[model samples]
Each structure stands twice: as structure tokens, then as C-alpha cells.
Target: MAMQLPTCTGIRIRSMSDAHVIFHAVTLGILPIVSRRLDIEERRYIHSGCVCVWEERSAAGEGSSVTGIERWTDGRRWGPSRVRDEFLYYQEKLPEFEADEELSALIFGSRLIKQTYSVFVDTPTGRRKWHLGTSVRLRARARFYLTLICMAS
Candidate 1:
């Protein structure tokens, strides 16, 4: 049988007191997310769109969804000139999305640093909501975080 973590529940990472194990698991998932996003940062040619894949752990939860915001061709070099133009292009469409009935957003930014300069927003309709990190990540994180909290309980 598989070894389970020792928590209140039957099987969960949180129950495991061993920091190394939990760290390994979380990192395994989060690292690729960071690396993949970093690659986009360098190219600066994001294929803007929405991904409608999210996991709902419970009945009452915000539901975390992964959405695409920006795309970069180069994997290691990008400057303000390119990123700025893209930022403006995406921000212009936010009001249009918010106006619709099937609308809500989840913002994403660089997981390495707490900067909100660029973001990836996830909408209910599976549209990629794009914006600056400080600009949108704050709002999106709140929704994702809340959903996570509810699911955990």
C-alpha cells in the first residue's frame, strides 16, 4: 500500500509532518509553472487565451484555474518596450469582459518575486485575461486563495 501522510484526513500533503516530502511535492508542481512562465517572459510573444481546467476540491470554493496572459519568444531576454505594448493591448479588453454576465477573473504573476507587472487572468468563460502583475495578480490571487482555503476545510 502507498504510504499516507499523517493528518486528520486519510490522505493529504498537509497531514505529513515531514517538511521535505511536502516541499518536494509542492515544488514539483510549482517549479514547472515558474519555469514555463519565465520562458514566456523572455520571448515576449504570449499567445493570449484562456484555459478552462481547474480543480474544485469541495462544493463551496472559488475553484482555481490556470489561464494564459502573455507570451514571449525569447526564453531569457525581454525589456519594457515589448512587455509595455502587450500590457496596454491586453488591459484595453478588461472592461469588455467585466461587463458580461459570464465573467470573473484570476490574475497570475511571476511566482519568484512579488511583482505585479504582468499577469494571467482566468475567466469563467475560459478566456485568458491578461494584465500587469501589480495590476491584476492581486485580484486574481485573492480569488484563488479563497477557493483553496474553502477546499482545505
Candidate 2:
């Protein structure tokens, strides 16, 4: 059975504990793509975001929709560079993934694994949402940290 991590209910970047979960995950190299955005130090300051494991599917069963695992991000203060850097880093990481046929096939051959990020900014009219990046992790290493945090609350 696939292990299920605790879900994030209304999590945001303002929460220190929630942000730490992402930092810790990146520090451990749990999500190679996400980790590429940081220069070791920046990872420490990424204190506003929630991580979610999502499964994409198609209702028609035609295999036309995205499938497999995905990491979704909803954060505050994440900049364009952060997401852009990660996308570029994936290019370098692609070669290494060749060893894993399943992962390589899904990522290179098919578009199963994907990522979507959104940033929230505070404004006079409350929080404004900035939708960013439609694109496309780990063997639950990151999930473990998130699970702990979820269970605590």
C-alpha cells in the first residue's frame, strides 16, 4: 500500500513549523528539483509554504491527464527565481535519473510527475494570490517530516 502522509489543512508560510518542514526536506535532498533552487543558506529562510502530495488522474480513463505523484506548493514570499532555478536544475538532474528506468521513463518519456506553485502576498485588500509555474519526488523522506508536523497539530 502507498503510505499516506498527513494532510495540510489551511497551512501557510507564516507558520514557522510549517516552513521548517519544507526547509528540512530540501536539506535532506528529499526533492532534488526543489533543492536545486537553494544555495544551502537560502533553504533556511524559506519559511512560508505548505507541501502536498497529489495524485493526478483523468475521469475518462484515457490516460490523457497527468498521473503518478506530484508535489504541490502554496507559499508566501517564494519568488520567481526560486521556481525557475528548480526547473533548470531538473535538467542537470535528468541525466542521473537515467539509472532509474521507472522514474526516467515517467519524467522523460511521460509527464506524470509534476509541480505547481502559488505564492500569497499580503495587500491592503487582504492576501493576494499569485499563481505561478505549471510543471512537474521523493520516497516519502519529505513526507515523513510533514507527517510529524501534521500529527503534532
Candidate 3:
């Protein structure tokens, strides 16, 4: 049986084997964006039960990029070292993107845009509805932050 623990955005710790612990992380937003931001090619493949992401000019073409994740069910043991390395690599490289407002908004909700908007002037009922939508978004954001904080400690 494997045990898993959520660490942070896109990162987790899992025990898939008695001999090794696996660190798994899924890139946030779009893989192409992640590849560009991290200066990697936007392609993914599974090798020895571990997924690898990088640009392969030969396989694709010069100046061309492919973006996607691949999964397999061959039942090979997940290479813990490779998984851990990927987790650490992303952990080091992703902080800036994670903090970016545009990127965060892509994953989270937009802060500036109201959840609900009126086409014309706001009537009292329209205003109330807008406020309700805003409040719901605020609550969700608060909950997300709270969860992050709790996970950190």
C-alpha cells in the first residue's frame, strides 16, 4: 500500500515502495507555459515509471515544442530518485511563477475581475448579487490560503 502527503502546489510525497519514497509534482497551468517559464521544451515521456519533461529538438524539430503529460500502466516501480529530482527541480524553479498574479489567476480566480458583473448600471438587486459573487470568491481564496498555511506548518 502507498501513502501520500500533500506538500505544496504541484508537489507531494508518496511512499510507493518499502525501499524508497517518491516525490511527485505536476506542473501547474499549462505545460507549454511551464516549459517556457522554466526554459525547457514542452514535451513529456515516461521512462522507468517516471515522467520526464524536456524539449527534444530531434524528436520534434528545431524551434518546435510539444506540450502534454503521458501516463503508463506497465506496472514498473516508479523510480524514486527521478521523481525526487523532478520535485526538487520544480520546487526550485517554480516559486517565481507560483507567485505571479497572472499565472496564479489562471489556476486560482482573478482578483480584479468581479465574479459577477452587470451589463449596465447596477440596480440594488444587481449590486447585491455582485457582492454575493465577490464574497464567494473571497471565501474560496481565503480557504485556499488557509489550506496552504496549514500545510506549510
The candidate that achieves the highest lDDT relative to the unseen native structure? 2
Compute the lDDT of residue 93 as modeled in candidate 3.
15
Q: Which digits, one per residue and each the tens of the lDDT, describe model 3 over residues 70-142?
A: 2212222222222232122111111234467766755444221111111121222231110001112333446
Query: Considering TM-score, where higher is better, how would the candidates rank from best to worst?
Result: 2, 1, 3
Of candidate 3, the 10-residue stretch with the lowest lDDT total is 127-136
RMSD of each: 18.8, 17.5, 22.6
Error of 2 at 135 (Å): 12
* Candidate 2 vs 3: which has more lDDT: 2
Per-residue error (Å), model 3, residue 135:
35
Q: Measured by TM-score, how close is model 1 to the native structure?
A: 0.17
Which whole-number lDDT from 0 to 100 does residue 33 have in model 2?
A: 25
Best TM-score goes to which candidate? 2
The Cα error of candidate 2 at residue 31, in Å, is 21
Over 4 Å off, model 1: 1-136
Q: Report the lDDT of model 3 for residue 6.
A: 16
Q: Kindly give the number of clashing pairs for every candidate.
A: 17, 3, 1
